[model samples]
Target: MKTFRLMSQIHLWLGAAFGVQVMLWLISGLAMVLIPIESIRGEHLRSDEPTPAIDWADRALPLAEIIDGQSLTVLSARTGMLADTPVWRLETPAGPVMVDAIAGQSLTPVSEALATQIALSRQIGLGEIVSVTSLDSPPREAGLSVPAWRIEFAAGETTPPTTFYINSRTGELRAVRTAAWRIYDIFWGIHIMDWSSRENFNSWWIKVTSIIAILFGLTGVYLTVHRLWMMARRRKAERLGGGGS
Candidate 1:
């Protein structure tokens, strides 16, 4: 009985000591689960040069120039070919670009297309969520088809998430947005870090909080069991009339 009482006291004290932190953890966890931190923080609208007027040949050279210093390379170039619609395709080291086969005019700045893809992949608002991945690889078996260019690459064991689509002809970024994006953004913020995509789950703060929560729950269980056992024994004694004193 004394041991049970002691355990009860200890449990109470432990819970009281960590009560605030436990509440915070629950709130934070719920927020992490329900909202996308990315959406909550919101994304900054990037202002870039508007659409341009130029042909595929002129645009391709400059686009190649922009990616030149980078890891981009020209993979294939087929002229006078078109999609179901009249569109020309230019393959690059990074990805393929579709251009208006007939226009001889540049559709959009290469920098702008790349920039918009990068920007949309981020969570910008209080409940927004964005996912980004490099599509500089070959196609996978998923049903991912792009009119111009669709970035298809596998990150982790996850399927190739289409991060962005480009106006192959115009070099413009066209990303789809949804109402549920905010919830995903919040979840992303909770899961990821701000500065870089480094390992955030192994941090000391998370460790400490986890340990405290575990202790708190264990102590609560112990106290509840002790109380239930004591009540049962007391009832037994009453039924026995104090052991037939």
Candidate 2:
């Protein structure tokens, strides 16, 4: 009986203190699992164009000529397309630098016309071009670097807006954002209790709440088992008393 009373007190207090947060955790977890991550990221709206093949027949400019007067410390180099033009992309210590594959001319700070062409070519099911803004600083979305282009699509009543971020220097597609992504981000922020960054799962508040929730579950289990044992003993006692009487 004393043990049962102790368990009851613990269960009641813990539930009262952390019940709302526990409910939020369960609801947010269910939402994240139910919705496919790909849909949330708007991958369905991605361009279906096949990757352009590199032409080996075209004579590429000599590497020495491309880096003659530059003091760049190259990290890596690869071949890719920028607005349908083949180019050699080099990742240096400073940032990405582009050079025409055949002519070996430098191409940095991609022009607006080329950025628009690249964005439109990679996006599907988008309305007419709404706006293109160059960002020199990181936006709210995570994992994006500076010197990027934000291309936004018009929104309809039923269809929400879609935005694409492209690396202005390398012309690489960085990220895709849509209305669904924003919804997911909101719930994720609440779940992690890190509204500012939305990525810190190791916050002190979350750790404390999680510990309390665990204690609540343990006390509830103890109460359930104790109640069941007591009921069974009571039934046996009544049966024996009736027989002896």
Candidate 3:
């Protein structure tokens, strides 16, 4: 009886204290599962648009010619795609920039017109283009820090519009943000109990809450077993009393 009372009190307080955390875990988990990962990643909406492969090893200008007289120190350089156009991506002290592989000419921070082309070439399956936004520095909301172009698609009849971030320098596809993905990201932040970064799952908040949840489960199990044991004792005593009488 004392054990039962203690278990009941612990269970009640645990629920009262950590109920919201439990609910957040449940809801966040459900939200993540309900949305298909492919859709959330905006992969389902992509067409198999074939980008130009790098074919400039022999015909293109040498690496030294590409980097000649540049002010900032070139960190890295590689042949890559800028939309359907093939180019050389160069990493520098300032930021990434592109060089025309054949011409050995600096071609980055691509203009808005080129950024739109990059978006259209990459995600041709999405909705009609509604707007284009460019920033010298990447937006805070963008998980990547590289300067990028934000291409927003028109909302569909049944679904919200999708947004794609294309790297201004290399014209690389940085991120695809669908409505489902945005919601999932929010729930993920709550699930991990990292309201600020939304990326740290090892936060102490979640750790403490997990410990509380475990204790809550153990107490509930004990209460169930204790109730069953008490009922059995009562039935056994009644049987003995009846036989004696």
Q: Could you give candidate 3's per-residue lDDT for residues 1-245 as a string of tens digits?
A: 78789899999999887898878889999999997888788776555545557565777887887787467788998767666666777888888888878777677877888888877877745678999988768764566676788889887665568898877776677778886887888888988899888878788998898889899999999998988998999999999999999
Q: Write the per-residue lDDT of candidate 1 for residues 151-234, one digit (tens) a residue.
A: 332232322123334444344445423334434444444444221322366666567656766877887788788789989999
lDDT values for all models: 0.46, 0.80, 0.79
Residue 69, model 1: lDDT of: 34
Backbone clash tally for model 3?
Answer: 0
Over 4 Å off in model 3, which ranges? 1-3, 16-20, 47-59, 93-95, 136-141, 156-160, 221-245
Residues 61-178, model 2: lDDT tens digits: 7666666635687777777777677777788888889887777777778777777888888876777779999888858782576688888887644446888888878777778898
Clashes of each: 31, 0, 0
Clashing pairs in 3: none
* Candidates sorted by TM-score, best first: 2, 3, 1
Please give the RMSD to the true structure for each candidate, in Å: 12.9, 2.9, 3.3
- Candidate 1 differs from the real structure by a C-alpha RMSD in angstroms, to one decimal, of 12.9
Candidate order by lDDT, highest to lowest? 2, 3, 1
Which segments of candidate 1 are over 4 A away from where they belong?
26-55, 58-199, 242-245
Task: For model 3, state the Cα shift of residue 51 in Å.
Answer: 4.9
RMSD of 3: 3.3
